[model samples]
Target: MPDYQIRTLDDADIAAADALFLGTLHLPPTAAEQLDNLRPSYVPGRALGAFDGDELVGTAMSYPSALAVPGGAVPRMGAVSRIGVRADHTRRGILTALQRRQLSSLVEQGDVIATLRASEATIYGRFGYGVAERVRSITVNPSTAEIRPDLPRVGRTRLIDAAEAETLLPALYEQIGLRRPGMMTRPAGLWGIWRVRETKLDGLARTAVHTNADGVADGFVTYRAVKSGGFRAELRVEDLHGATPTAIRELWRFLIGLDLTAVIKAGSQPLDDPLEWSLVDRRAVGVDGVTDSTWLRLLDVSAALAARSYGDAEPVVIELVDDLLPANTGRYRVGADGARRTEATADLVMGVAALGALYLGDVAPSTLAENGLITWSGEPGQAALGRADRLFRTPTPPYCGTFF
Candidate 1:
């Protein structure tokens, strides 16, 4: 038998769990004051700890939230975070146990999906988590970049103090709603941590709200200006969202117009960000990097498949292999109409991780098949793959701007 016992953590165990999690990352211990501020974000019984005898050796926790899928379906999801195994307990099956328990709890609690920002790309795939969304880090030379004259400017942006930002930003975000697939509704628990980070941890971060001619708030951005060297200041955009393209353009105009700013940088931006095209010189904006943003796991296969809308394509049967959750290992026929379980022969075969990747409509089935992540079970494999690709295709690429 294993030495560690997995159990639900209580409020009193929050500090130890947090410390253990931080220690695994080689970070400093959490300050008493900061821990107190973040305590409420840790919901009671949401955290799970692996105890060896009486010491906490592993930790994993998630916050309640909802994810927006294609066709405007918002299903319950768990925003998983703080997953770590103590140094001494590395590769001892502690983390796997914690994940098993956590995933089971999420399923039992009726969360249709679970999402997490993976610290390492390679760690979560074995646990059935797939890279569902990708984001780009961009650096724009504001001095050389100029907004195109053809783009309409119909909004004004105003800077707000931290106090006002604390109150207005959340409401503004809700008003804008989730316009893209993979976007999630932030709960108060998650917002509490974000608030502390922006307001308390980052002193340089500032907020700006955009309003149209009607004087109604429609968009917002939070950024910080940091001195890189002599006479050069880099404006790092932390969060930016807009209800309309005009509002986004105006916000960019304001940032570009900031005096004495040398460069503007933003991470976790959507792959299809319009800022580049809006610029008079498209090359003025450089791609710094592209990285995975959201690792998604579909806790319920049938429900998740039916949740998102599909494109017009012939029906294709897909056999999903889910080892951890055996109940999901079955054949499912997916088409534009909807998804349902069927005993028909599967044309395409893939694991649950590949399904998660395909579910967001971010990556195409043929692409996954080409990459050897998927295999064919029936004849005319290319045709079946093409059908699957068209069936899961989305107009806009999936993007999850929220970082948890």
Candidate 2:
């Protein structure tokens, strides 16, 4: 017997585990902040890892988070991130054991979904996790961001200190979280993660905030300029959060207006975000690639949907189909009339993975229907269902600043 088993982590395992992680991924050991945030001090071992005797081979961690089903409320979610296996232990059942235990444990704890950023695109798809969202990196020649000087400005903008983000970020995040599904809740100390990434760039990163008419810091943009080969500038955006469209637009405008930059590279954007459309030369920017940002497991999709506010009108009765988890395979009635809940109903239905795909608007009704993911009664029902179906992202795109 190879003698391999999966179990909860322990603080004593940190040093060895960190070493194992670095070796598995073939990257230089990260700074204290990256490791600390991923494996918190309190839970030094909150995650599960596979071991062979005293040797640590496979590890995975889950962060406390949430998922908002538009038209319903937010449900507590566990984000399974930083999953890795030792290079030497390529096969065997280490990964399977870890993931199986993690998913079951999360479901047992009442998590509506278990999300993660899949490193190996081929790995997680087999674990019943469908592609829920996509992110794209853009390399823009900043010297050419020719933002219209008089671009119809909406809200007052100010350059807020990164330290101030702690107090302001949560409010803005909550507002956006309601409409987006793949968002995660940032705990107190974890608030410093964004700042650390910025500071690591040696002052090249900058942030700009937007305040509403009532004087609220509703949004912020974090970006940095790094050296590029051939003397071209490479700017990467850490994060951008805005409560209202007006604020988001202005923050974007501010970013576009940055001076003396050669290239602006941004990632973690939503697929259909309108930021590219806002540019004078639409084709100037190109999507690097569309990779899944979040994977969802519908532990209780019904409860997830009934807890949030939805579209502007009436109600929708949907039969949700989950091929993996049989529990969520049923009918759910969601309405924006303030009454959101799942009921045993006799009606049409859609697959859980399809809903996950729709979670980011990556999948549309006509396409889902065409693919048999959902049945469209007629043109009217199709239109109503599409409108009633809320997607989780802004026009700028939803990007998790950190890989987690």
Q: What is the TM-score of each predicted model, taking all chains together?
A: 0.96, 0.76
Top of the candidates by TM-score? 1
For model 1, what is the alpha-carbon lDDT of residue 128? 94
What lDDT tens digits, residue by residue, belong to model 2 across residues 1-404?
A: 26887888887676566667657767655476565543452244347889888778988767677765543345787777657789878788788777778777777777877777777777875566767667777766655555454557776777767567556666666655544544567654355444434444543666677877787777777777676556555667778767665677778777766766676767877665667666677666777877777766556666655454544555667777665566777666655554334665524466766665555444555566777767757666676565544422223333344454
Per-candidate total of colliding backbone pairs: 0, 8
Off by over 4 Å in 2: 31-45, 154-182, 189-203, 212-215, 229-232, 276-288, 305-355, 359-361, 365-403
| TM-score of candidate 1 against the unseen true structure | 0.96
Poorest 10 consecutive residues by lDDT, candidate 2: 390-399
lDDT of 1 by residue, 200-235 (tens): 443277889999999999899998988856876789
Q: All candidates: CA RMSD in angstroms?
A: 1.6, 5.0
TM-score, candidate 2, is 0.76
**Cα lDDT for residue 120, candidate 1:** 86
